[model samples]
Target: MFRNRDRSAETPAHETALACLEAGIAATLPERVVADRIALDEETIAVGGATYSLDTFDRLVVLGGGKAAGGLAAALADRLGSRLDDGCVVTTDVESGSVGPIEVREGDHPTPTERNVEATRTILDRAEAATAETLVLALVTGGASALLCAPAAGLALSDLQATTDALLASGASIDEINAVRKHCSAIKGGQLARAAAPAPVVTLAISDVVGDDPAVIGSGPTVPDGSTFGDALAVLDRYDLRETIPDPVVDRLERGVDGELEETPDAGARAVAAAADDWHSLANGRTAIDAARGVARERGYEPLVLSSRFAGEAGEVGRVHASVAAEIVAAGEPVEPPAVVLSGGEVTVTVDGDGTGGPNQEFALAAAIELAESGADAVLASVDTDGIDGPTDAAGAIVDRGTVPRDEVDPARRALAANDVYDDLDDRSALLRTGYTGTNVNDLRVLVVPAAD
Candidate 1:
């Protein structure tokens, strides 16, 4: 399943690390998780621990957007067969396509575009036409925030693009970034459910945020939003983004905060109350971590799951992982050597340099430096589960004691400081490229420590 499996200068430990990462990524595939949680019988359809009878609705419509929406819809089509009347979803993956009654439309990611706006209009139109008798199966996941763009009144696609670019570059947390998105979008923050008012909407999600908050995932199109316009404005102030944000975005947010405009539906809103019992969003970081631990054991390494909610700056997290490996080698306090430590979560990078590198690349380079200084023999690898880390082509990077030569230590330090780890890793053949993994669950990090010699 790994595309870059063969490369020169391969170490046995490097191969093991690659296997561990591939295993974790594979475990989060949309088809695998969707099949496990969704199923159908003759007259009854089950999803996320809830059962809905086919006889309860006059029509079954599938609607959603995300990185995994294509696969999720495919799996549902297989199970639902002819019962599915129609379906449509937006995604960034070009390989995604329609199957049966579902059509997976293309959309730009990390930034909203005109094509995205047009495609989203169709989704909203279909949703708005739904009635109480329509059974709506909603797929919400990572990338949906951008893929399902529907700018609020007075805002253009340019406004959304500018705001998104600034927010992503500001190193803001996903929750904070999404709070702003929900308020500016017409279909987000429970508006989709409102559009399909009085209909029974069941949502199946693949979480990519740290806390797995359903309202934060894909900006909560089918779930109730707890954030308000005031919260969105606060995020901008916290990041000092008021000056850089487009004028229209600022105006819209300010107007909503002052009650001059309507707010996105909150948990107590009537729109959410109408379809409260019929919604669900499942699949999270733990889903991948659990599967990864199993793979570690199969590979003959004692596994230590650090935490499923790991967060912080990428470089600092990398150093901490190195420190833990050093402790295992020196004191054996946490666990003996020949152990694989696993963690999953999204990490941020505060970009100050014009260099090209993502959070995972910075993490690996910083960890390599720490391991070299501590004289620790360990292999550290990290990758965004989506197969795209920041604006780079490599999924992430891997490093070890021998990754940086003794004489080149100073140069490596300079590269990391300049945020140019991508060039350095590429020169050393350390980057891992698997293209788009067809699923996203934030990031997966692994530290492999050898047994004491």
Candidate 2:
């Protein structure tokens, strides 16, 4: 699946890291996850061990949004075939080929657009149309929050845009960022389930957020939201973004806090509890990290899964990973040489410089600098599982001792300082561009170290 398959073919360590990455990406394909977890058996549909009798429902409508919605819809179409009456899904990708009566609508990502609002409006309409006899199969996945944007009352798309910009640039955690989103949007934070109330709503989710909280994944359109407007306001204040955020957003949040605006349906809300089913996480970061570990072990390396819940600043994470790799090389501790270290989680980047790079790119860049400084013959491979890291086209990058010559370390450091890791990695032919992988599970990172000669 790697377009530049031979980019790291010369180095055994790099080859192992790249192979592990491929294994991870392949494990979480939306169709594959759906096939493994969802099954249709005549009057019965089983999702993640929960079986629903099809005889009870006169109609089955598929509704949801995300990066993997199209693929998930296609898989469901094949499984359900003619049983699917109507469906609509919003996604960031172009309308790729879909099956059955499901319609795929395009939307923007990392930021919501007017088109996203329209698409999400249609999705809400479909949800609201669900009758008592209708079974709503909702596909929730990563990127759904942005793709399924429907502004709350008194809020415009531009308001959402400005608020999103401020929150994203605030270096907040995903939970914190999504807390604000859940409160501001019309359909998010269990509103979709509320719309489909009185109808059974079954959700199959591909988790991209840490902790796999249904409320956080895609901002929990189907499940109940535990976050409140107060939480959103606290997030803004935590990031010191209260003053800079759009006035409308601040007003909305303040109104919500003051009980002037309605809050998102909490976990105990009847609408949320009535229409929602036992949420299923079809795939997640652990799924990718486990598959990668298997590949690493198969390649004769002792694989150490550092953590599937790794978080924090990308650069700091990178340096910590580098330190672990150097330890393996220096003292043969933590399983010795010929070891592959792996982790899967989302990292943050406090973009101080107007440079082009995402968290994974920054992670790789920082790791490269650390390895070079320590004179460690280690290789690092980091990539967003969805194939797009941050705002850049490059999925991520690979770095080894040769990625930067000893004399050029200064320039690499400068690039890292400027958050311009993309240009540096691109100049050295290290960026990995795999296009859309039809799935997302946060990020996959691998650090490989070989024995000294």
**Tens-digit lDDT string for candidate 2 (67-178):** 9888888888888887889999988765633468998888888989988898888889988888999999889999998899999888899989988887787789888988
- Per-residue lDDT for 322 in model 1? 87
TM-score of each: 0.96, 0.98
Cα lDDT of candidate 2 equals 0.88
Candidate 2 residue runs with Cα over 4 Å from true position: 96-98, 274-277
User: All models: lDDT?
Assistant: 0.85, 0.88
Q: Can you give the lDDT of residue 449 in candidate 1?
A: 83
* Residues 1-453, model 1: lDDT tens digits: 556677722766677778888888887888788667767776888776778898989999999898888878888888888889987898877654688888778887878888788878988888888888998888898999999999998988899999999998888988899999999999999999889877778888899988878888899898888898999999999989999999999998999899999888877877565555665655777788788788778888899999888777889998999899889889885988788899989888877677999999989888888888888888989999889888887899888877777778899889877878899988877888888888989899888887777
True-vs-predicted CA distance for residue 229, candidate 2, Å: 1.2
* Candidate that scores best on TM-score: 2
